[model samples]
Target: MQGEDDLRGLAKIMGFMRAVSIILVIMHLYWFCYGFFAQRQWTLELINKILQNFNKTAGLFSHSLYSKLFAVLLLGLSCLGTKGVKNEKISWKKILIISSIGTVLFFFNSFLLKFPASGATSFYILSTGAGYILLMQAGVWISRLLTTNLMTDVFNNENESFQQETRLLYNEYSVNLPTKFYYHGNWHKGWINVVNPFRATIVLGTPGSGKSYAVVNNYIRQHIEKGFSMYIYDFKFDDLSTIAYNHLLKHSHSYRVKPKFYVINFDDPRRSHRCNPLNPEFMTDISDAYEAAYTIMLNLNRSWIQKQGDFFVESPIILLAAII
Candidate 1:
């Protein structure tokens, strides 16, 4: 039985190694293509043209596309490498850290030497080469890490068992608390009580519905003041800015308040201003909440599809009808 278990573990490791190898190969291919065929001069000109046409507004579409493409590529490589190792011990945290570091270094080097018009000088050439070497080493390290049984905590420890494992039967479709919420204390005169954490609810209404005020003023003031980190993805700078500014002044703690307002004017590149969130010159306003929500959903769905291949699989007619 012990021998069989060892064999299974080895097989899982081998599977992960194979997947990492494929991912590395793909990365190499991308680099080669960019270096040889997609000439930097042309690419820069193209980007300039795109910027000229779309200006700051291009971020709405372009950023999402770029993010999704990278995400899918990573997910595909992961799936290919660990198709049959679903039950195997995996250190996701370590994997994330290593992968993020590798990606950052890759871009850093590429931007520094490769993208700039002037090529690397004799003094910096060796350093640039060393950076590339480190990137390749990072990739190899990730591959080895994935294959090795380094994460003993995953299976060998009872105390470290996840909540799902503690339960007898595992069901993925369990109701859980929404990650975020908008609460209004001032509107109802403290009538709003703390709702059960497990329930997912959305308070929807028109402009005067107190949604923005609740989210920015009341909820942020109550929860965020108590050391909770919160993010408000406000597209059009409005009430969020007001609340943030007020919080900064009122709180004795040095609260850093920054508002980023983008002036996406196609006419003038110089006028295309983006304020720093920490030292924001403008207010926080979000125009299209629906578009923002849709973007979030789209990304979420893509991630879901990557994790569970059959997540969106349905009858042909049903799928087609839904798409229509």
Candidate 2:
């Protein structure tokens, strides 16, 4: 991880390098096209002028050549190398090798044009050298940035609360379920690992603090919209049950499927369905029986503060587990 400043700095440097590479590529391409199609007579005139001024006759100046075409191809390769370096798709050493070869070829072309001794040629040579130097500098800085470690800057371990909050973001989830979590006054989408078979959500808040409302408004609405099956436990109040029932009704009307809703209230003797923890249907297998016995013992004790239970308390659980 890197700090925002470091990341932004690296990006800006890469941008500058990319710009330089593109400019070099375009300049070479323009020169190549001009030399190939339009600049034959001008090249002849320039060569004649150079020969006359230098007081020398050279066979090399007798004909127009496609030297700029080679420059164009080399510069194009350099541009691609710079782009790859910026994207981290090419190794720095490889880019350096490619750019160095391009630079050598560029300098060779410049050398071929240097004997003409014109103001335009001098400026072109200076600018090309400066551009290539900047490109190399950018590459070096980018490599440094990639190699440097900024883990401490990005993660402030001294801030325990911040670490705790960020830890939830990296949790492995079976499904990335979106939760329109309300944080810092605005509603933003977050994700939870509740879809995992071993994972579940536990929302806790004091009474009248919108705990039920948050679940009903955000999560319940999402489940209904996505046509997902949901099981809600509303212990004290029927808030969640009512919200689920309404959503189910709306969904049924829209999809034309009459979904069933089961309610089991242990507090209401008249309306509550009979639920037996010791039913034979629950103990058909050893795993089921073990689970049933554990659940029964948990419900009876309600707390595990004392791990080593006294004989009076442990004897019944052991007896019930053995019998099951």
Candidate 3:
């Protein structure tokens, strides 16, 4: 209630300021055009004397620079009472443009440095009058823009968030992802299509973000169902490996050549099938031995990858290749 009263009082004060400014502007215009409004009967001696006193004041003349300046200042002050809103956004650039042009026109007493002839003040009045009205409106708009509640005014309809594509595309080798999204107050079904599964697609996410359960497992199951031969490198021995083993077992009939499931446990030799790395059955050329030796040494010491031509490095590699 106190705040409301304060606002009401401020509005009343602003109204008084506006009234005083307009009255002064009119008085100034009338005094400057005293000859134009001649031949009028004097109603009272005191009223005539009072108006005559103003005629002597230099600033009351329309041609005086201070006359327009005083009016502009008061109008600007009165604009402080302009009301602001929460949901609407005002364009400051437009307000500035209007106010600047109005200021220039309001101060214009002549056109192109040429003053009108005697008794031809009507055109000057019309131009400045239009300019005064524009200034009045622009001033109020600027005040309202400055006082607006920016937080809520800017977010009335959350337009900054980008629009996501919701169209679902499909192809012969595409992996489809089913989803649901929100729009216009209700949830709707959506799909993300990976059109070419043969092209490498990396699944990336933070821990517990469903990298395995939602995406990896789905891809494994679908690929198995499509009769794809997979070589899975599982970090968690049982997590993905177990899923692939069980899925392939169920979908084994889908493959033209029934694929066997083999488990290689490097930590437990008893659980792993014994195999020789230097087995001659798999080597087609001498380069195959060198490749095996290169991979072994690099895995043992990764820095050796940059030291390929070093004698100590090449010697061991050559020895390993001969043994293989």
Candidate 4:
């Protein structure tokens, strides 16, 4: 029991670390987006400039080297943090020692490279700037790598926990249900095998056989603590509104509940009003709201078909029929 509790505690810590690492990675990725997509050549040029500036002996012996070295150390620290190392064990003493050595080397190199034609100060400044940039890159890389590792670890841990929880639940309810619940297939059937809290055991039943309640009570409620987001589509407003309200109330500020109901009747003015506000309305020059809704529906349908992985030469005909 103690072992299980310890595992659970470690799992929780790992989960939190994973979330933080992911957030940091996302922020770093956002910052690097321009370099990745738009200004890649400029970024490479800047890196090259830094390398050239550091090649000079005087440029090498500056505060810039210490800064670069410290930056690298910071990246290592981030990795250690992700790995669940305590803050006290981070070894600031070692980092300071290395930084001091780097600082001395930088100044010595600067003195050696102070020739008649060389602009030692300018070179030092450029090298230092380059080193700072490299440090940022190192931090980003460390965050990204740690995020990946943490996610993988947490996923594995959660999967095992889920299996254990499911078994316990099954034992409690096995007498009630005909089929015994067991782990099977990818929890989330996407490109990656993500363990979906919602997509658990599929109900083998016809309509109005309590399938909906079974899904809601058994799966959704069970994983409520895991910070799962869900959207339930129901034609009836009352059911959907109730579910949405309950979700909003239960989750409070931490979770979001968005209920989207398809209003097929475009002829009714109220129906038009009920449509997604951001939806395009090409029919009226004043507002493209209806058109936007239509586009969303079309995209949803297309996505469904794509998920099915069925392609045909006559797909255009089927799509036209759907539009009609």
Steric overlap count per candidate? 12, 0, 0, 13
* CA lDDT for candidate 1: 0.42
For candidate 1, write residues 1-324 as lDDT tens digits: 353467568667755654554454343333323443355433455654554454356442233224224433543444433322223433556556655665554444433433444343222334433433444444445554555454553443332222221122212322222222222111111233434423644668888886655543665565434434456544555456456546644652633543332344335567555534322233233323333333444555565434433544323323433332
* Model 3 segments more than 4 A misplaced: 1-172
lDDT of 2 by residue, 199-290 (tens): 55677888989876655456676566555667777875477778788878877654445567777887776765667767887778777776
RMSD of each: 30.1, 16.6, 17.2, 20.5
On TM-score, who's better, 2 or 3?
A: 3
lDDT of 3 at 227: 85
- List of clashing residue pairs for candidate 2: none
Best by lDDT: 3
TM for every model, in the order presented, reads 0.22, 0.37, 0.52, 0.24
Arranged by TM-score, best first = 3, 2, 4, 1
User: Candidate 3, residues 1-324: lDDT per residue as tens digits?
Assistant: 354578679989999999888876776555554444453541446755776676577435535556677888899899877564433545777888888888787786556224335445666666677778889989888786666545653653322322344677866466777777654435667776777888888989998998888778887888888888888878888789899999998999999999988777798778776777778898989999999998898899889888989999999988988888
Q: After superposition, how far is residue 100 of candidate 4 from its true place, in Å?
A: 99
lDDT of 2 at 94: 66
> Of the candidates shown, which would achieve the greatest TM-score relative to the real structure?
3
Candidate 4 structure quality by residue, lDDT tens digits, 241-284: 46655655665545455333233444456643354444334245
- Residues forming the 10-long window of minimal summed lDDT in candidate 3: 156-165
